[model samples]
Every structure is written in structure tokens, then in C-alpha cells.
Target: MSNLTDMEIFARVVSAGSMSAAGREMNLSPAVISKRIRRLEDKLGTRLLQRTTRQIAMTESGLGFYERVVAILASVEEAEAFVSRGSAQARGTLKVAAPTSFGRLHIAPHLGDFLSQNPDLSVSLDLDDGFVDIVGEGYDLAIRIAELSDSSLVARKLAPVHRILVASPAYIAKFGVPASIEDMAENHVCLAAANQDPWRLMGPEGVVTVRTGAPVKTNSSEVVRECLLAGVGIALRSTWDIGPELRDGRLRLILPQYRASKDVGLHAVYPSRRFLPAKVRVFIDYFAGLYGASPYWDTGLETWLGPVEEARAS
Candidate 1:
């Protein structure tokens, strides 16, 4: 349609935050971009963007229009690519969201192989330590490490992540390892992030909530990990996030019998599975293969299960 070009220009301007930047990206002059937007507004009879010297922001109607436009544009491009290629090699771009710590330490490192395998496909990964609306924000996929809520999106269990209590050896040596759950309250400074409270541990017998005060609190898990590694305090973290440190003996587990909360687990969520692109499917499969049975959470489960099965057979 005649107005689709204007809609695309408007979307680009909003994405780039300025007409000049959008112009540069689109290989057009700022004046041309402005004129196109003006024509679009004339056609729609609504002001979509509030233009200023420094930045261009979307109006309420503009925001709504932009959302629809983005989805339509993406679908069109996907259709064109599918028709052109006639194969599973996905073209265009993939927009992904993930937690900051996990993205940096785990997902980012593996992206190279994915990119290399799919030459036509490109990715834009956003790493933020906050909940993101995948559909509303136009994200193709989200790698989440949390207890998934009931949603329309389809989700696949990627791996099990154990939430474990840990502290540096130096801190344990100075404070003395707490043998019982009650002693942890008196001995350990509980380091937490994002206003999270001290973890509650459950064992065979009963439940115990360890009340701990944090001298240093941050919103970043990476910062919390650093503080724990620096002997600042005892902290609870996901096993997938601290496997290397645990293996290297930089941090030691405490009260191994008391299991930390298992509520949060790793998941790969997408809009649907019916038409899952090859790239997304391959990535999910790769992640599952990499951490399925011998996941970071399976610290003692494999060894314990093996003996139990052997004894049952005997």
C-alpha cells in the first residue's frame, strides 16, 4: 500500500530515536524522512510521533500503530523469505530477550555457532534483568530462568537449574560452617538481589527459613556473585550460573542436605511450536542436549539414582 512505506519509515524513526539516524540507516535524507512521516500523518489523520530536537517519541496512538506495524512488517518479510528460499533456513532477524547474567555468561558465548550455521539469519539479543513482554514487545523468543506463569505462549523445558546456598571458603572458615539451619541465621550474612529475601530451605523432616541481613544489596546477580566470591556474604544462586566457580572451589556449598527452592527453572519460550523456525528449534534442541540429564542441577541425583536402581535390580 502507499501508506506502508510511510509506516515503515515511522517505525524506523521511532526505533532509531531520531529522524537523522533513521535517515542514515535507510540511506535517505532527514528532510525526506520527515516529509514521508508528515505524509503518513496526513493519510492517517493522527499524530503518531511527537518530534523534538533531541529525540522522537511515539504518541499513544503512534505506539499502538507501531506495534501492529512491526508485527505486519515482520510477517511480510518472513513470508517473502520463505517464498524466496523455499527451505528451513530462516532469513530476516530474530529478536531475543534474556536475563543479563545468563545472557553474558551462557547464551552470548553460544550465539557464535548459531550465527555461523545460519548465514542468512541475524539476531538482536537484549539482556536485561527484568521481566519482558515477548509478544507486546515483538520479541521472537525469551530465555527465562523462572517459574513460568500461565500464558498463551508455548514453552519448552530447557534444563533444570538448582538454587544452591554458597559462600567463599574464607567466609566459612572465619564464621564457621553452620551445621544446622538455625545456626545459618546467626553465622551468615545473607546477600540478596532485587529485594529478594533470605532463601527458605526444605529437607526430609521440615522447613526452615534462614533469616539473614545483607550489608550489600544490588539488583544484579553478577554483582551478587562478585560479592559472594569476595567473601562478603553467603548467597543463594542458580547452579547453572555458578558451575565453574563451584568446580574450581572458589565457593563451597553449605548444609547440602537442605535443598534450596526449586521453583525457578530454565525455559525456552516462544509464541508457538506449530511453525517453529529451524533456527529456534535447533537452538532449543542444542540447549536441551547440552544440559538434559547431566544438568547443573543434577549434582548428586545421578549418583544417587544409579545406586538406587542397581539395588532395586539386585
Candidate 2:
């Protein structure tokens, strides 16, 4: 317990960047903070930090020790929260990362309700469309919409992310709908996020890959959707993104028979399954419950598009 306290004090000192700052934050004197850190270093038999009148910096050993201590303190906090508060009452700051458009459209709107449910809890949501290094960035959880590759992280499937080849009626009327997968390049422009990922479609016969010759390539999904709406070209789009447009007849599925075979699905991913933090666990459950089996966005479209089959996690 004394060591744990010392560890916590050391972490605070590092975070605060000075003994005086840490002392002020903890309502202790600089001398006392210095003494605690010294005791900790003596006990460990190594210099943890190099201090001067101007600045302080961690030694190589200190950096390694700090990482381990942070994990230990976090585990301790999680255990106490679970034992004392029960699983339902989750508190603390949960740092989550998600795709920008999806996070803004789906997750952000529902965050209010989740926060209301857990009064003691606060959340930090980082919205990035590009693939994020969850562990490297110290994210508590990440909401990914992709067929997950083999990873050390634990994933909870929230829902199926069915993507369909789509074009606006205006674009289809002008360019003429692609009669076949091979006809895509000759007839219409292909809007892609990344130029490398060609359209992989699964048809009655088998799988067919088509490169539409990146006429309009952009990294942003929002830009792709905008270009699609403006009759820029045919693009494979998430049903979640264009559900309303499809239902209202603004956008129509081009190749109704063939669908994008990429087995991408919505997932709530975290670092580990063991001793999971209550805050992260509850947020995952809450978000999953909100989406259900058939998300509200993907609702009503089944009437015209036929039953949408959900892809399961492998």
C-alpha cells in the first residue's frame, strides 16, 4: 500500500512536470513530494528521475517503471470500482476513439444518454477516420467498422456493416448503370477512399474484383459521399451512411445482385478481456444495445433492397 501510494505520487509528479506543481495539486509541500520520490527510488535501487532547478526528466529505467506503475494503478482503480460500486455504477474518464463520420452520426448523438446514466463517469471521444493505434495512443476503447484482422485486442461485434455499390439516379441516368462488374471502368467513374482497394464483389458465379480507375480519389468518406450525391461517380458506400438517401430514392443501389464481399462489421474493441474496466464494458454494452440487431439507419430499406444479411465476427 505504501509502495502504491509512492507510485501514485511519482506518476503525479511526472504528469505535473515538477515537484512544486505536484505538491500544489496534492496539497503537499515540495520537500515532502521530493522525499517520497527519493524513498521510492531508494526502495527500487535506481534513479527514477533527473531533476534540476529548471526541469525534470525520466531516466530510461524510469520510463519503463512508469509504464508498469500506470497499468498497476489503473488495475487497482478498476478493481475497487467494481467491488465497491458494482458493475452498473461505472466512473472515471474513458478515452475512446472512433471513425469521424460514423462517430459523429451515430455514437455522438447517443453519448448524452450514456453520460446521463453514469453520472460519475466522463468520456473523451477522439474521432479519426484513419486507422488508429489504440494501444499506442492509450485509448480505452475503439469503435471499428471493418473485418478485423488477427489482433491481440478483444473485439465485441456490435452490428453488421453492409456496404453496397451505389450511384445517384442522375449519375445512373447520365452514365448508364453498369451492366456488369467488368463494365464499371468503361462506363462510370469509381470514387474510392484508397486507390489500392478495388471493388471486391461477390456474385452468383463467384467473387470478381474490379478496378474502376480512380477518377476521383479522396481519403475522406464524407468527401466520397458528397461526390456521390453530386453525381460524381459510383462508389461502394456503407448502408449506415446512405440509408436515408436509399430509402428516399435519392440514391439507388447499382449492382443489386452483387454486394461488396468485404466482411466488415461494427466492433467495440478494447485492450483485454481480463479485468476489464467497468466504464469501458458498460459503454460497449450501452452502444451495442442502442444499435441492436438491425440498426435504425438500416431500417425500412429491407423492403426495397431485400433482407440484409448480417456478417458475423470470425
In model 1, residue pairs whose N, Cα or C atoms come closer than 3 Å (at least 3 residues apart or on different chains), thus clashing, are none
Error of 2 at 120 (Å): 1.7
Q: Give the TM-score (vs. native) of candidate 1.
A: 0.72
lDDT of 2 by residue, 1-314 (tens): 89999999998887788899998999999899899999999999999999998667989889778766656777788887768866546788999999999999999998899999988999999999877877546688999998899876789999877788899998988988888877886667988777336778766656778776556767777988899999988888888899999989999988676777777899998875456777887899898998877888889877544523321111
Candidate 1 residue lDDT tens string, 100-187: 9888877888788877877877889999888888755668789998778897678988876667678899898788788777777776
User: Model 2 RMSD to the real structure?
Assistant: 4.4
Candidate 1 differs from the real structure by a C-alpha RMSD in angstroms, to one decimal, of: 5.4
Best by lDDT: 2
The C-alpha TM-scores of every prediction are 0.72, 0.79
Off by over 4 Å in 1: 27-47, 92-97, 122-142, 148-157, 198-211, 214-219, 245-250, 257-262, 268-285, 292-314
